[model samples]
Target: MAAAAAVAALQAWFWNERFWLPHNVTWADLSGEPGPPGSGIQYPRAGHVFSAFPLALGIFAVRLLFERFIAKPCAINLGIQDSGPHRAQPNAILEKVFTSITKSPGGKRLEGLSKQLDWDVRKIQRWFRHRRNQDKPTTLTKFCESMWRFTFYLSIFFYGIRFLWTAPWFWDTRQCWYNYPFQPLTSRLYYYYILELAFYWSLMFSQFTDIKRKAAKLANYAKYQRLCDAFFMLFGVVFIVTRLGIYPFWILNTTLFESWELIGPYPSWWLFNGLLITLQVLHIIWSYLIIRTAYKALMRGKVSKDDRSDVESSSEEEDVTSNSTKGVLSPSSNGSNRINGHVGSGQWTEEE
Candidate 1:
């Protein structure tokens, strides 16, 4: 494959004499035949990098399976329910019109739709309502998804810090560039890099699924919004610290500024740096979107509800009612009133 060939070429170029060959050592000395006692010479292997790609794929498969079979079931047991069975699907023309134009069809528009579809106005209304509700992910589903990501990010952040804490590069970033490609990739660093890359790849793969679930209408929008805001804030902060802060200050600075002596204008060095820079650029763009959402919330004096995701009718109210009924019973009148107030505020009223 082209990719495999490219990796092979880069590895060949990286190990050439111009990079990392000591003054006394010849290419023959790198044949691993016990050069000298305690010389600490390591003949670098490019296989480690290629092997990590398959390992990353394996981990991704495991995570996907775990989410579907274990996490989803556990979430359901914790009382996360989809709003109920949807009404029969609308015809393609009707669906296209409703989604593209206006979610909430008016009196005259409803009449026109009824005429066009040859269905009762009430049936058309129900179809649109169900269509909208179908887009909103259940509370339990969102909770589990958020918890999974939060746990992964939190663990990886700490793991990365621990792994790099005692490394020479951690203390003096310039050291990363000193030996350059001659420094053999350690197993710890190899796994760390591959796992992190895999996580990002998983995110990219599931992005469409996340978008579908991000419809922003839940049984308890206020409570859910609080969770969403907190998670987004945490994720944004961690991303900035790792991708924007430490990466540029440590990794990029060393490779771009300090590594020139060892790398000596190699195309591989430029390609590798280019990839890191591209990741930083993506992080900046996502950060901007996150900040814009927060800014809009601040300016509006409330979390901005995504009206695009709102359903038109109260058919889904039963799901909210069931959720309330499952709550703990209060003995005192004051306690009952407080609980009622909270539920009332959280639930979607007829007006909504």
Candidate 2:
């Protein structure tokens, strides 16, 4: 609601001739018939800002469809497993116990849980193993996700450089002040802003999906921790440089401070600056969280798992899928012989 009000106020200010005109120019001068060819001014179209919302929605829909149909299937074919069967889900009480207690139960504890759930010990063990595997994303899936983000960030960074390199605001920060609200927003600028906004929106949308995969598991602790650490460092550096560095040093400085010299104090100016500052605050908060995580990694020499992650619900179906694959065996005679030998050894050990 506040955002809507701010946009509306900005629109009102943009269309107001009194706010935009120089001291000498009047509405009469602007409306005068047969004005000198060079005397007329091109007013900014405030309505263009409203177009951003629709563009954002279109981008989101396209991203959703692309991920669901194209990207997901491609990843799956590349060895990424999707959620498994629905019947693998445990009852509510068991699920709650599993989540709250140990991830892996063994010895007497495992037997107790098996008896409580009225399932065989082997089944309980398989469930725990499958649950752990579900929480760990395949290597190919991680690569695909990282590559997607890297591509977007690289493209946007270069595009921003190309667009702003020759701009007056890039050279002389005070130039942003000179035009004030009368500066028309070009198509290039509009697209740039919308794309940046949409990228962040997409990140927020997919955040939950990847949260469980962010930390390393005990099974492959060393290898996974290194990968997690490297990615975290990369993400933190990029975020700090882009959001905390360039944005405040260049964009916010010009819009909030330099522009004030020409525009003076007005509700629209304050509102716009307020929004920019609000974004900066959010960036700071996120950076703080990232820093905290980095500190923990540095001190403990490992990435700590986020316990609040929604892995419990997601692991249920994954367990079923993994268990179903266990029944399949190689058709080769050598494989059959090896499996038979293993089964014979297990039976002998059980009898002893």
Candidate 3:
């Protein structure tokens, strides 16, 4: 009941008219009936966001099916084996310490655990390390997960281009603010908005299993930078140049100042610009990491792992490296926080 009341209060505060429309504008002003009064034009509503919840669930269901039937099959075809990491040896004593207690027990704690398990301290440490690796997602799982996202963004990209190509706002920036908030919500834009929201919802629902590690691939890329120098360098250049160079001056300028000059100050306008600015902040933080990686990479002649995401742990690294001729970059620290410590993923570089 307390939770329910809090939710209700939040909804009320969020939907408050003064926080959305301009001082002279009320919800009623944009509620369909135009001044000419022949046809009623539907404007965007706060309730439209709520409608995305149901669609999001539906999209989530579709994503599960897509991964199972489509993505998994594709991964198998590409020679991505579905096998998981090596299992840790069975030891109830060490398992408890690894789980409820500490993953990496101190030397003294290891001595105590070693006695209970009747195993050497090194054996106990290996067990814990193997246990940690077991939880990490397999390459097959990562491929399937990323494939789902790739399909989604690709579809949305074409859809966005098609919609934008026909819009007056696409050609002329003035069309965006010409009629202001009174502009009617078209069916195409409505569906476009919902599908995008739903795709993100799919990610949020699966965030736990996936650990939502956005930079996992980044670490993989850094593993063999000599082979992927072209791709990795291109990715870094595009990421840094777009976010740090062009975004603040071109995109941010257009969203914050240009929008204000065209539409005048309004609550919704401020909210829209605020979100754009907040996203830019994420870009800046990630940019610093990318730059840091590039500088070290230039000096070291090899790229480092991403410091923004979870660092992979493995006593198996030596064994994994022995199989390949190329040298793997030094592993990043495992104690780092998630990218920006946020719900969604951000970019960052790893260092040895």
Task: Give the lowest summed-lDDT range of ten residues in model 2.
Answer: 343-352
Per-residue alpha-carbon lDDT of candidate 3 for residues 132-154, written as tens digits (9 for 90 to 100): 77887887777677677767876
User: Could you tell me the TM-score of candidate 2?
Assistant: 0.53
TM-score, each model? Answer: 0.58, 0.53, 0.77
Clash numbers, per candidate: 0, 0, 5
Q: What is the lDDT of residue 64 in candidate 2?
A: 65
Clashing pairs in 1: none
- lDDT string for model 1 (1-352, tens) is 9999999999778777544454544466555523355565455544445655566667668677766787677656656654544554747977787768647487897898889879887667667766766765555556556555655666887988887898987898667656544455555676677787777666665676663324222223324556655555555577678777888887778777777765455645677778888987887876676567666767765445433233323445744554444344334543332222236446422211
Please list all clashing residue pairs in model 2, or write none if there are none: none
Ranking by lDDT: 3, 1, 2
lDDT winner between candidates 2 and 3? 3
Once model 2 is optimally superposed onto the true structure by TM-score, how far is the C-alpha of residue 14 displaced, in angstroms?
12
For 1-352, candidate 2 gives per-residue lDDT tens digits of 9999999999776667555454444445534324346644343444445666666666667666665676666666655565442333556655665687647677888778788889887677666665555556554445445445545666887998897897877788887667544454555676787788766665666676653333223122224557766766776788789999999998898787777667666645666778999999999987887777677778779656432234433455555544443332334443332221233224211110
Which ranges in model 1 have alpha carbons more than 4 Å from their true place?
A: 1-44, 53-57, 68-70, 73-78, 89-113, 120-143, 197-227, 234-244, 301-352
Query: Which candidate would rank higher by TM-score, 1 or 3?
Result: 3
The all-Cα superposition gives candidate 1 an RMSD in Å to the true structure of 10.9
Query: Considering every candidate listed, which one attains the maximal TM-score?
Result: 3
